[model samples]
Target chain A: MDILGDLLLGVQTAFSFWNLTYCLLGVFLGTAIGVLPGLGPTATVAMLLPVTFGLSPETAIIMLAGIFYGAQYGGSTTAILVNLPGESSSVVTAIDGYQMARQGQAGKALATAAIGSFIAGSIATVLIAFFAPLLSSVALAFGPHEYFALMVLGLAASVVLASGSLLHAVGMILFGLILGLIGTDVQTGAMRFTFGSFELADGISFVVVAMGVFGLGEILSNLENESDRTTVLTKVTGLMPTRADLRAMLAPVGRGTALGSVLGILPGGGAMLSSFASYALEKKVSKNPQQFGKGALAGVAGPEAANNAGAQTSFIPMLTLGIPSNPVMALMIGALIMQGIQPGPSVVQDQPVLFWGLIVSMWIGNLMLLVLNLPLIGIWVKMISIPYGYLFPCIVAFCLIGVFSLANSTFDIWLMGLFGVAGYILRKLDCEPAPLLLGFVLGPMLEEHLRRAMLVSRGDVTSFVTSPISAVLLLVAAALIASVLAPAIRSKREEAFQDED
Target chain B: MQGHRTKDFWAGAIYLVLGLATVILARDLTLGSAARMGPGYFPTVLGGLLAIIGLVSLLRGLLRPGELVERIHMKPMILVIGATLFFAIALDFLGLAVALPAAMFITATASKRFRLAPVPLLGLVAFTIFCVLVFVRGLDVPLPMFGTLFGG
Candidate 1:
């Protein structure tokens, strides 16, 4: 009953002329670039964040969120049309989607991904719309201690689930937290790491750091193997799936949506992991497993559903608790912060229109993506065929201009350059920048809560454990860390990443 | 010092140095009691944890065997980063009209596909103008088409 009221509110805002145009633009642009082999939703969002600064926060977010899943839709297109996945989450889809393409089922594969994304996205949007208010109510009860503990759990979970060695992830988090603590201290006004530079007074912008690390850094690393790249577009036909094809995919889509919705809500898990998990699940549960890598329709349907569903529900923790489940959410959190809106439970109460409108816009965006992707599949295939040589320069130009536009400062550009190099080196060392971004975004909040909790309890460190909710959160964090050490889970985590490679 | 995993060894060493530097830099700030933390408290603790993690990673690098670190591609790294730096330095002095093309041109050289042909150069110039028109004329992003160098 209450959801109906919220849905009406969402409809009133989402149907506005400007919102619809921008949302469509976002999905269209997102899909175009998403078809680019190396650029994913994360990079696309980061690249385009500067464009959103000039608009209203609601409209800006609507567009950015459109880009998020729009990229997913486009990525699966590339997965089917070309064997190369435009994004990591679509890797599993490409395995079977490409095989189906070789079998002259490119149209069916693309249609399956499109239709499945719509189903999962529609359902997932409803879930976010309904669940956010409830989670906000629960979060409303959280104190500084509970907040502190939950953040600890979020950070720990990100590191544990992070690819590569657990030690490296922890070290990266520490490094990020330290980097975040740079600039004048808010409470004490003491400069921690500004080194007396006047520009450093405000602290490093997360936009610059993120754009450099994920955007330019990625470009540099990609250029390392630029000479040895190839693309062969399979001719796509028959955009509609037959009745038998649709029937075969029905169960996998349902199962994937369910699995994805759950995993997407977990800290440090999002579309990438969910798609991988759902693919593995489909293989395990299928009657004919051998047909999987050779173009089983379920293999295409399940992961596409899972990926879209995961992308949608991953917004839950971000919208409710302000903790990013992944880099894209971190960018969203950064966008929200840039708009001067603190990202937490209060958003639901203070900005109900924004809260509900974004949820409703996702469903609208998914519908638009489905319509846009099918006819535009040919264009997207052409995009992936463009050599990386030309694309890299354009992306670099965007980065140079994007960072400069943020504060109209050359210093941020220089900082981005430094971080670009740092990012490349970090990647070379087998370290991931995703968890570091998480830590950097969460660092200030973590320290603030830690201090507030301590101040409230008068320095008794045990107070963290004394509070029941806080204690349980800490226990969960401990268990997550312990699980990382269990050797078995560690191997399985490696197994998932290796499968994609 | 000379075991396998040259990459991890260097990564750990860098982390260890960074951790030490952070701790040393923050030594002057007061690390107050737990109940009332000073500005330095979180950084100091994080820095210490970093050092410990670095130590573990370093030991692992020395003891365990893994694949050798991939060789760094200095040419692309330098060209890309250098081109970016050039853009930053030139944007104010040279303006987007000249600086953007220059940056894009330098970046094109990062790949082996770069050349001095008129078409490629013309394309670069056209793209730079398009960017200037969009960001400057259309969006009014405050970048100058012609800067102090041209007496604008």
Candidate 2:
């Protein structure tokens, strides 16, 4: 079917009473959490995953997708108002956004972010509708060798792009892969790492690990330093941007959307990278670069647009190729698998409603966020002031109940607690859990492909390089690693991520 | 000795131990050839790579200046994990009615500003009711409102 026909079908599905309600709820909850400092979409989604089990796949995904992009919109609200980024992707937005708020242009800044995000989201949604099918069709042609190579590229790129020590990131990936090995082997029916636990015979649930690490772990970290949050603007005055502001923001929004859409498609690149890159780009191309850190509308416009766009487009890989570009997408893929749907090239054909409805709902979710963020900005500003003391307990309650609901087993809860401690320690050690999550999700698939490819080639290791596509992919992975290892590029990479620290 | 204090040194040490453990544990599994890769093939290879990476990071930590591991705060970390474990142990015995509030109460103590204020007390009560209503009544998650010990 044509994109228009598909989108129309999606509209029909998304506009259903339940879907629409869940979409609204998803975005609403997303914005609420996004406006709250220290709570992120990853943990929120992980905590909420089990709740979606009772819903239809399309509805479930639409709601989850809403939370993802809706976060980008809500993140900018806190960034602008409180000077604290509610989400990591909004870190750059705070640089100029908070400045604008302090200058009594909080309304204008908020409005710019909303408008920019909506436009970028709309454009990216269209790009997904246009491109996802093409990519899926291409991926359908991949053999075991190609898949193995592709996963290697994905893992390699994720490690390289992730901020922190390269060795640590790689180690985390291997650790995750090892963790993924702890279950009965599919081919042989032999247990690999269950350690005689019957509960682990089926393998660790993704929700359990995610909730423990991102959810409980984050709460532990947040509690470590409970700093008081000070909201700068009590009241926002101008709700609309002036024509001059609009003109200044237009080019940046367009450029940011373009950059974000491209970057979001790359493995390990998503909202965070896109926003940072857009901020850097805006500073470079600006006629008055000095105004960047001091209330440049372009800085607010660019990163907000980029982040939303990146968040939207990052779904392309997960939707088409079954490869997650980031942790949120990894969770989504896990959700799909739990729904008894294998996420890959065939998903586009087999689950058009899910694929298309999710795409269409993103646009609707963006619209919801724009309206929700602009008029209801006061509520969010108030929400940030809500004490961590009250919030953490509730978060803990939710996580416990959520994990317990997985099978009504306390064992999972204990496992979650174990990982929570591990996660906290790992963070202290400067090892990112993001790559590890991705690796865990991809591990079984990677091993399967590797083994199949070897068998197909009769143990010929050269088959990987012999296949042109696989060869190119491996070369790309090699180049990425080499670039990160090179002293010149290593320093440059560190500088790019420097602002984050 | 100072190098032993670096975050990388500890992280690398942890990874090394985990990697070596994985390799050692997988020794009993059939290590089939490259043509017909066994269940052990992937883990053994990955385990070895991890060990190598861990060793390199460990050496790097010892040889070069690195960031020191931050002070570990035992209070929040332990309390939060303790609360979850408390909930797990209590759920089957006391049920959600008892377990949820107790867990929330324990978790509340993790924060320095925690106080026995009326607002937080009300919040605890309200949140427990909300969870019971939502998860138990609305979603029917199969968890007992009150557990076996309570004749739920």
Candidate 3:
């Protein structure tokens, strides 16, 4: 399908009043939460997931996607004004952004971030519109063998890139897979591990697990620390970037957008790593690297651009292949599942309006964020002071009500509580929850494909290796694991030599 | 601070038990041939893989030292999780209005900045009302204001 045709369909769905209103509401609320410390797009989305249950799938997703746009943009707001990043991707933005604030150029920095993000988002959205259909067609050609191999590669890649020890990350993935296999077998309709209860027959809802882990668990962890809740940013003197500032940012935005768009399509790469990579690239290629931590326009513009671009392109894999590249994408997949739409290549074929509309809304959401956040910076800044004392309790209340609304069984609330404790325990052990979520989302699918592929080959275990695409995918999965282990083995050898000496 | 090895050992032990449990549970299900696999075949393999992973992790925990485990905060762990459990159990008996506030109040009290001030008290009450109006009345979540336990 031509890019123009798809986007035209998207515009038709996106421009509807209800869809437009929800898109605006999503970005607006997303930005609102993103500006607040310790409450990010993930937590906000997880907590507010129940609100989408009543809406159509297309409308529900537009609002959620809007939140992401708002949050990404809002992350820069806190980074510039308060010297603290509201999200991890904005950590690099905070380095020079906070310096600009200190030097009384906060307005210039904020404007650069907003404009750079808008430019990058516009470019990446176009890229997605063009590429998604092509990718979906390719995905449609994949057999169960290739799909299974791809999932294995994806899971392994996530563990290698996770923010924790290899053992812990692996452990989390294994644990999540175990959790995913808790229900009845799809083939035989035989209850696999349901034990006795009817609730166990269908397995646990991803909603309960997500809200419990990200939302409730976060509340538990945040409540442990005593916060001062004082607003650090005193005042803003200016609100626009000069011509010179815009000129300096042009290259970084271009480079960062290119870098992020490519990286975001890779397995286990998304906004957080893209932003960091862009910042490092800017520093290395800068004419005056010494000016890096001292309020360089490229420093603010590059990462902000990269993060937004990465966030936009990360949707490609989830939209076409039904694979989540990160935790946020995992949540999006969960959202799609809840809307009763199976996530895969057929999403475009089955629900063209919903699929294209979401793509269009993402672009429109970015535009809305640019227009909404810039004029309303003063109001967003004040939101940073919203105390944790109030926030945590409110989150707790929502989690309870939200989980309760799912099937109207109070039992889900109890299940969420159980996972709340489990999530916190995993966090304490330094096990990243992102990979666990990915594993959970992929586990059942992985099993089905593995079995089907074997069944198709008539008991020939070597059939997976014989298929070219599946073989290549398996090799990639093996390579990822080998790369991770190579470093550890080398370190151990060096340690042994040092001990002998 | 005991190193994370202690925690790793515990984590591995849990993984080991879960893997073994899965293996045991699925033992009865037919593990059909590769061409026509039964329901137990995939999970049994996964269960075995998990068991091996747990064993390797356990060995690594013994060999390599790691970061210190974070100190657990009991107050919030008990109050927050407990409050959620309390709400779940109480919701059917006491209804949404009472059960919701009870959970929120417990969680709010667990906060370091929380005090018995009117602002916080009022805020909690107001949030509950908002949720009730939105979820119960607007969304029609079927949560009663009072429950069978209250004879309402």
Candidate 3 clashes between residue pairs 3 or more apart in a chain or in different chains:
none
Give the worst 10-residue stretch by lDDT in candidate 2 chain A: A1-10
DockQ of each: 0.80, 0.89, 0.72
For residue A48, what is the lDDT in candidate 3?
Answer: 73
**lDDT against true structure, model 2:** 0.91
What's the number of clashes in each of the models?
Answer: 0, 0, 0
The interface root mean square deviation of candidate 1 comes to: 1.0
Predicted candidate 2 versus true structure: per-residue lDDT over A229-321, tens digit per residue: 888867887987789888888999999999999989888889999999999999999999999999999999999999999999999999999
Output the better candidate (1/2) by lDDT.
Answer: 2
User: What would the per-residue lDDT of candidate 3 be over residues A124-228, giving only the tens digit for each residue?
Assistant: 998988888888988899999999988988888787666556777787787788788788888988888887789878888777888888887777777766566
List TM-scores for all candidates, in order. 0.97, 0.99, 0.95
lDDT of 1 by residue, A161-216 (tens): 67677888888888988888998888899988888899888899888888889888
The C-alpha local distance difference test score for the whole of candidate 1 amounts to 0.86
Best to worst by lDDT, what's the order?
Answer: 2, 1, 3
- What CAPRI grade goes to candidate 2? high
- For this target, which candidate reaches the highest TM-score against the unseen true structure? 2
Largest DockQ belongs to which candidate? 2
TM-score of chain B of each: 0.91, 0.95, 0.89
Query: How are the candidates ranked when ordered by DockQ, highest leading?
Result: 2, 1, 3
